[model samples]
Target: MTTVQLEHPHAQRRRTLVRGLPLAPAVVLMLVFLLGPILYCLYSAFTDMALTGSSETSFVGFENFRKIFTSDEFGRALGYTLFFTIVSAIIGQNVLGMFLALTMRAGGPVARAVVSAVVIGAWVLPEVVAGYLWLAFLGEDGPLNQILGFLHLPTQDWLFSLPILAVSLANIWRGTAFSMLVYSAALSEVPREIEEAATMDGAGTIRRLVSVTIPMVRRTIATNLMLITLQTLSVFGLIWTMTRGGPSGASTTLPLFAYQQAFQLSQLGYGTALALVLLALGGVFSLIYLRILRLEDGVR
Candidate 1:
């Protein structure tokens, strides 16, 4: 009986290991497929690694980073990227998302259906398709200008005159749905009993939202902000498809710069350096968000 008991425990351990065996391959695959490229890119960033031309590509140390700092184009692209991130991801996604969530919470089926249809339509469309849609909407003879013409208003070249704003709006339209879904899920999780208690204690709508709702879902807000910011920071195709980083590079973000350098100008090394900088920027943002999450956890 004692022998049987010991053998049963060993058999269970074997069964557990057998069940977990497949996970080892998955983990190894993830490290190889994902971590390998990231490690390679980080290494390449420090060296003058070219795709073509010179057979004598050597390590240039911080020269690439120095060039990034001194370049006027880099400065402008950084500023534009920051502006787009704040405007579209922070303000457009968070604020608009919250508002949509609140409205939907109070709305009837018809209103909910309408809002869902509109937001989800944008969300479900491919990025390239959304880019074309925005291009048509912002073009010289597009619906926007036509509307202005109908109203006897001055028709300006939206894409030319306001490339940043046009692109920002397009990003907001494309991304607001994700934020809306996040906030909606968070809002739903807010306990009705707690809200009722607040109402009974003379807490107004704004007070309840600010104090109770917001605090309760602070983690969700932080998570959504981090995700949207990361996403907006990496945007290339939308801006490229719309403006091609044109109108004198007014709307050029890092991704566009990288593409232009690598493929357009055939400066593969420089482009990879720019990509490394973008990765660093993303890392910094992630750390900030991580700290916030940790602080929230401590508070909780």
Candidate 2:
């Protein structure tokens, strides 16, 4: 009777401890890495930290953000960042990805192979290499102009004339594959029987897509949009190597602005604050996606 009683309490203790084991590693890792660094950075952002000891350090509070808001450069960069994110990440990647997925679904093996190869090639290329390749293609005397010359059509400088467009195109080229893969996987889960039922109802391609496919894939679309928006928000290497924030501040998005301030101008604290702002932007998108994902889970 004593043994039984002891075993019951011991078993209860074991069960309680066992239930918490799964959380241990994740909690430890977050404390050591994620939460710690974020808190440190948040504190650093309000200070006048510098690369050199030339300047006196002090707490500046909201002065950094105020400086950013008042600066035309910061305003322009914010506007440009929003524009690029919407155009390249949202419209270009998401829309084109859906189109590609639809095409591949209805296309022959050969077409699918060719299209997939083209997209995967762009996806797999090194960013610097991709940037230079785009540079060569968009330069004043590049092949695009050469082709236009042969066609007896006047050609403008692609990079110089349309820096934002050039970077947007590059981003689309590099990122469309991710969205395609996502949509394709989502498309696969859509029941074939349902699709056929829609077709039997005399629904044309557009009607079927709007009424059936799109509705089914809406969750995937939202998830992909959120991911790409966050990813594109912090894109620095590709755009920097391509435009370097351009002929003026034309293509100076937040990342470029941060880089220019931190490294180029040696305003480490200001740059860190800018980085924090970018982090906040990413957090905003993440929250939206997380809510969407949760809503989808509930629906499912």
Candidate 3:
């Protein structure tokens, strides 16, 4: 006869702990490399710390937050940041990329290949190099003004006269490739038969797109928006290298503000506080996106 003995509760718990032992090292590495710094930064946000100070730190409550909140420069930076994000990322890149993707999806292979190569080339450039390229392009006596000079058309120094617009345009040109690639993949996954059936039912291109293609790929659109928005919110190198948040802080986004505070002004605590705010904003965006993603899954 074969018999089985039930394990004791303590023994079962020990077995479960042993089973989780392999994950312990990975958990420790993550804590050390990722979560540890974030938590330390958050803790330092409440302190009065300087980049060049002694090891001693003192808590200052919400003084740093209050300082930035009431400062005109911070308010201006926040407003310009929001405007830049909305214009360059949400409107320009997303819309133009979607249009490009749709066009390429239905275009001849040669046209698609050429256009893709051009767009991807711009996107593949390093951020600093792309910033310098745009800087030169928009400078006085550069290609843009030279063309205008040839035609005797009015031309202003683009970067000086329109810093935010110039940077937004540059970002749009560089970033549209990502959104285009995303939409292209999503469009490919869409069932062609549904579109064909809609056509047979006398649906126009716009009608079919509105009622079919968009609905089918709505999840992809939401996901892409979430990713691009977060990325745009954290953009620093391109804006800094090009404008350095110059011309009276016209392009001083949150990240630039943080950098200015931490390294430029030696206000490490204030800068970390700003970083926390950015993190919180990103968290809010992520929550909203997760809800949208869940709803999309449910609908499907």
Candidate 4:
């Protein structure tokens, strides 16, 4: 018989503390860097802080929130933010990515490699670079107009006339690869035998995809939606570089509007409040996605 010794609770705790010592530096750094700034921002949102003018900061309770809620600019920015997120991330990237993944799955290895390379090449570019690229592409005298002119079609100044759409399309082009990669990974995990069984049951491609593949990858879809929605909500550089949220704030999302308030107008407190609202919006989206995941788990 082998002799076994049980460890005391104090010994176990001591060993655990020793093991956790390695993470202490990381925890301290996060508190100072991440949590510290967040706390400061939370505090600042209620104050009358400014980027310029008086150095004194005074807390004004919910005045900032009330002003923001009543402001037309904020409402417009909020609407544009929702439009951008819904059109670009939720619909465009999600749909296009799944389509690309399905197409690649049905294609030869060489075709898949070529398509992935081309798509990911666009994705890998820095946001500023992508924005500039799209700006030039959609500029009044750019190649798109040139093509339209060549086809004898009327050409409009895309950036000036349809700034939001232009930015949304640019975002879709830039961000779709992430969704494609995520969906591709999810699709790979789905069993081939199940798909074959569905096929044997006389299910067409669309039916199998609708009835089988989508259900299997539903969790991944929700996760991707949450990530992209949050990302789209915070997009500033791309829109800034492309249109500067302009042609009269047509493409000004919350992030750009917040920047305008914080830096341009010197309203730091208002900007912090806007930032908090954006954070709350992201949190709402995360919670919804989490609920979906939980429901899926319950169903399983």
Among the numbered candidates, top TM-score falls to 4
Flag the better candidate by TM-score, 1 or 4.
4
How do the residues 65-128 of candidate 4 rate in per-residue lDDT, one tens digit apiece? 9999999999999999999999999999999999999999999999999999989999999999
Candidate 1 per-residue C-alpha lDDT over 1-300 given as tens digits, one digit per residue, 9 for 90 to 100: 334454577888998799899899889998999888788777777777777776867888888889989999999999998989999989997899888987898899899999988997998999989999999998999999999999999998888998988999999999999989999999999888998899999999999888887888889989999999999999988998899998999899889988898778877778888998998999899899999999988987
User: Residue by residue across 121-175, what tens digits does model 3's lDDT show?
Assistant: 9999999999999999989878999999899999999988989888988899889
Which lDDT tens digits does candidate 2 get at residues 1-300? 334454678888998799899999999999989899788779878988887768788999988888988999888898989989989999999999989998999999999999999998998998988899899998899999999999999998988888998999999999999999999999999998998999999999899999998999898888898989998998888998898998787888999999899888888889889989889988998898889889888988
Each candidate's TM vs. the true structure?
0.91, 0.89, 0.90, 0.96
lDDT of each: 0.89, 0.90, 0.91, 0.95
- Candidate rank order under TM-score: 4, 1, 3, 2
Q: Return the clash pairs for model 1, or none.
A: none
C-alpha lDDT of residue 198 in model 2? 96
Candidate 1 local Cα displacement, residue 143, angstroms: 1.0
Error of 1 at 182 (Å): 1.3
* Model 3 bad stretches (over 4 Å): 1-26, 295-300
lDDT of 1: 0.89
Residue 219, model 4: lDDT of 87
* Model 2: worst 10 consecutive residues (lDDT sum): 1-10
All models, RMSD in angstroms: 3.4, 3.9, 3.6, 2.3
